[model samples]
Target chain A: MSGVSEHVVIVGAGQGGLQAAMSLRTEGFTGRISLIGEEPGLPYQRPPLSKAYLKTGAADALTLRPAAFFEKHDITLVTGTRVDSIVRDTGHVLLGSKTLGYDHLILATGTRNLRPPIDGLEHALDLRTLEDAKRLRKELDRPRTCAVIGAGFIGLEFAAVARALGHKVTVAEAAQRPMARAVSSPIAARFAEMHLQMGTRLCFGQAVKEVDETGIHLPDGEKIDADLILLAAGVRPNVELAQAAGLPCDNGIVTDAQLQTADPAISALGDCAVFPDPRTGRLVRLESVQAATDHARTIAKRITHGTATPYAAVPWFWSDQSDLKLQIAGLAFPEDDCIECENGSVLRFDGDALTAAETINNPKVHMKARKILALQAPPGRDTLKRAGYDLTLI
Target chain B: MVKVTYIAHDGTETTLDGAEGDSVMATAISAGLDGIVGECGGSMMCATCHCYVDDAWSDRTGPRKDGEDDMLDCAADDVKDTSRLSCQIKLTAELDGLVVHLPSSQL
Candidate 1:
């Protein structure tokens, strides 16, 4: 604690940034913490935007903290403020005409929705931010027909909500199954069935060619009429700022296992930072609330305790679609093979070693997966099979 | 703001003013209290904000909703008759001074 200066300036006041500020204070760091956010309000949670907020439209409930909490914690929260550049030479960040110095800088810029190259793309809306969600909610108010371009979590979640609200919803996905990139095939198929049962149409392996004011046109010369269109294809990290600042960025702002950039003074986390996975050693970028908050806590400990511990928290993610709550603990790569347990839980393996477990409405297995992955020696395929994939016995 | 008392498992009580609309878990977390994590940020996805409504105040807190009732089974600590995920319990003027005991741990 005595080794550094007084101020810790954080860019991107998303979940990770706010958690970093809180963790710094909780760790007994009496430094001047300045949390800069581009959005014009208190930092709020993003996961609910696609699920509960869409159904309830309670925007205020998403707020992570009240304005009074920041003031009481002595944390300076600058809303609607964008940090233009990082003046590394001066150890400061440029906010237009003004500059703020930092003893250490944390970048949690997060990500933006990936806008695909579809004609009349302007007709589509996003659900990444509060503003985006508000606009999407407005569209849901009318007796509307929705065309969701992606079968990912956001698109599917929105489709489910729309279906629940008695709206005609059609989800067009280029992939074979919903959430295929995140969940295993069987799990994704199960969710696809859930959406289908709820009367949401799913167009699989169909690339949307264009989006007009009326609806979306598939590449197969077929068109679906929709009053509202949502583009939840995917997201790209906001790495331009870090790249402009001369930090190495691959899929995201590349950092070491400890989340430290090439420059020792700077660190990055959340959807924006690609760090080495403690289990697989693969450079991975996670966009979950769990990853963001965990990375923040790890960085805070290193800053406060002055101990250089590598970031190693098990990554977890959750997606709520209709009544099915899908939870996955540990990181699963595209190449990892998946095994369906007797209890219908999908256990992913990077070769023989258990990498991740995907559970449908099974929190116990998901929790056990997290605990197992956090261990020094996680169970291998043999051990898992011997225990009948119960995880508890292992 | 609605007044609420959060009693830690060790019997450490911290009373704070929770906004009229915010949940009991959010209030405890916003105050930087140790017991509740609220990891999912009131999403009800993670049961990290589990707390036991004091028997005296349990009736006022109402019954647990469907999602919350099922999620409590996954709570880090043992579930009780009055146990609830604080995220589901929104603070209201009528429930001012409501007491909820925090579990030993919220994963």
Candidate 2:
């Protein structure tokens, strides 16, 4: 395949899609690169849809790459066009009645907010795309109370911002703790306390039965009135295109360690792709800039340089709520034992082996934990203690 | 204002006055303290401002939650008992004269 005619067509022009195009050029691939996205404008990051972009209304900052970068890299970016289907037999993609052929197809469609079947959900707003953030920001201009559905990162982040802006915010979560699926219970409890201290009301362990014009109604028949309702419950992977193309689909588009789908010509990455974890060997789908960008780089190496190394980059994520910044170095399961260090760092261990480390506003230790985990033989507790708990010695 | 001391990896100590409600990361960054990048603007999304809180003052710092604990797993250096994300630590009067050691790298 080296030196042969290469034309790469990447679907979904978000962070991962843009990165794949950029990485291809960075790796010296001079072939034609076409990026197709359902959203309008250039590829942008979704992370800021709930943070600074929301507060400052800075949509420009969310751009993954400037429009000039695409021209400079000789990449064609097709925005505001939906890919109707992928014809595997013809090795082409159908975009709104037009068919474009490709040698390799990369799926970076990402995920969409899951809209559960709740009454009066039409009144509920979302915070996923840049436009959505802008709409929500405009809605926030008024002195209105908001009922935020879910206690996940996005929900809590929005709640914090709303409260800081002097708007009354109430968060309802079906789970007992905030971010229960993603973080440990202790962390969730601490976040709950922080939200409470910030004057954001929290309603946990109660499923929302409906969302009316007034507010949200819980399963227990309690109704909380509010002017706005923001749903940040969860996201569903964008796998319909792959599934329609007759490709294997799971919770996300199933990909191997190299991020290639079951079919050799197709590959997937970012929130839409589920690949094996380097540390745990479990299939996981991550919706972070790190994962999407790293996945793009890996795919680029494979396509341009012919490097077949599996995607083994360490996975990390962060979330901001109020003054607190939560940095995570690795993926951890609920079964992982949470050990509290003297300095307030939580070390998650699978038995004696450290699987992940969670740090709050502590970057130094977080970096150390990542390096330590990367080691062939990580220092044991006794060795770590002998060094006065200093990771640099290791 | 609370006084906080940041000890770098090279053993250089820089002292800074932290605002009452300012996070330790923000205080250190505002003080122009070396080794605190604070990427993601203290959102806890990036581990660029990782530090090692002194064991003696651990009680004042409280404990880390699971989300933070999970984030430390990707830090650039070795993990230790004193590991902490500086952004989560607020500079209150109770944390006066707090000290945090810097890591070698954040990459």
Candidate 3:
């Protein structure tokens, strides 16, 4: 089980960090695994924070693993601790007064919610972690008006819940359509309608000029009164630690397809890694659970078995907005053309090559799309059309 | 603690104490039992935690929700009549001795 040094220190004990530790053990890497997290409790999932956890308020369900799991897997989980710096030459990480050496280091620092430039931003709330969700849930308990600053998945998901809880909800997006960054315009249009149908107000092409305790002010000089304001604008990767260590940082920690940094002994994954997409050869950073766990598994395999195969897993993502679950397979670009399939799933193609597929409330189509994208040669428009848009045919 | 037994494809039965609030998938995952991937962390977005609820406890475990049923169709293994996404089934004190069979694979 021993390859090089015995200790592997992982920074950021979120989804990817925890998966790296768990996958290392499952891959038979019997080394000393130290998973350090800034959060004070067991590693938990973030997707539910904006989805079921908001409605159910079940904090335990968000936990990825319990304390017993760390003991059983021999994973040294250092909660409520942050790694200050990494010394590449000495292969050590400094955590406040303590310094721990590592045979290899993994950076799964993930990302933090980005707060847009607006006056009095302190009045806005966040829904990034369990703590944020708990606070937002408390705000939802009472009959209050909510103003979400973004129309991305998090913002829309929160808007849907806030509406369901009898709270007046208003989602304001700077773009013409909601979730324009992720989904196709057509799909975003459908979601916009769904929110409108649910008694939630949707404001497009509007930017927040300022935020006060009462509510948010639009650039058009319109004031919307809101008791709770949620800032779900977006997120930026936590790459300060890697940057301080002299590692290249783009939108995330730059890594090769093998997910290894310039320093071979160090690797990065999850929301914090900008790796080469084997399909499109584009440097992409994903924030989905699928990407995080898959990246962790790939890195674990390389560290344990020395199998340095380029990561080619087809990226998939899902967002639950009320009863409609939006699922996507593959990566879509802004210029990619979208085709509406018979099963109500939209397939995105970059010229001749299929880039991504988006589906709402259609898991079968989404699953088929994932399987198709995972292939060496994904089906193009002609093949997809000839197959009657049935993914099983190809 | 509610006792639950997860039978793997190889007929390896691993029984563990499950807390009342956590899902069966979470309990199995915490125990590090094989065959239950739980890729989506009980969101029903991924069918990696697909399992076959024993007929004896199927009624108590309740029926699969629409989302869970659709996800089971995507399970890597063969989807059976008793196939269920373990994540949707919350562990309860009443269902103390729940027994569910894990599929052959959960890629």
The estimated TM-scores of all candidates read 0.92, 0.79, 0.94
lDDT (Cα, tens digit) per residue for candidate 1, span A98-134: 9999999999999998988889999999889999999
What DockQ class does candidate 1 belong to? Answer: acceptable
Clashing residue pairs in candidate 1 (N, C-alpha, C atoms within 3 angstroms): none
Candidate 2 C-alpha RMSD relative to the actual structure: 9.3
lDDT of 2 by residue, A1-394 (tens): 2443389999999878987887788678888999999999977667777877778886754555557657767999999999999999989999877999998999999999999999899989999988888899999998989999999999999999999999999999999899987877777777899999999999998889999899999988899999999999899999999999988888999999999899878889989999998877888888787798889989988888766798877677878888887877777888998876666667777766777777777777777777787677777766765765555456
Candidate 3: which stretches are off by over 4 Å? A1-3, B9-11, B17-22, B30-34, B55-70, B73-81, B90-96
Candidate 1 chain A, which ten residues in sequence have the lowest lDDT sum?
A1-10
> Tens-digit lDDT track for model 3 on A252-322?
99999999998999999999999998876889999889889989999999999988889988888888887
TM-score of chain A of each: 0.98, 0.96, 0.98
| Descending-TM-score candidate ranking | 3, 1, 2
Q: What is the descending lDDT order?
A: 3, 1, 2
The sequence of per-residue lDDT tens digits that candidate 3 reaches over residues B4-57 is 998888999999999998788988887767678787887667888989999999
Q: By summed lDDT, which 10 consecutive residues of candidate 2 chain A come out lowest?
A: A60-69
Poorest stretch of ten by lDDT in candidate 2 chain B: B37-46
Indicate the DockQ of the complex predicted as candidate 3: 0.53
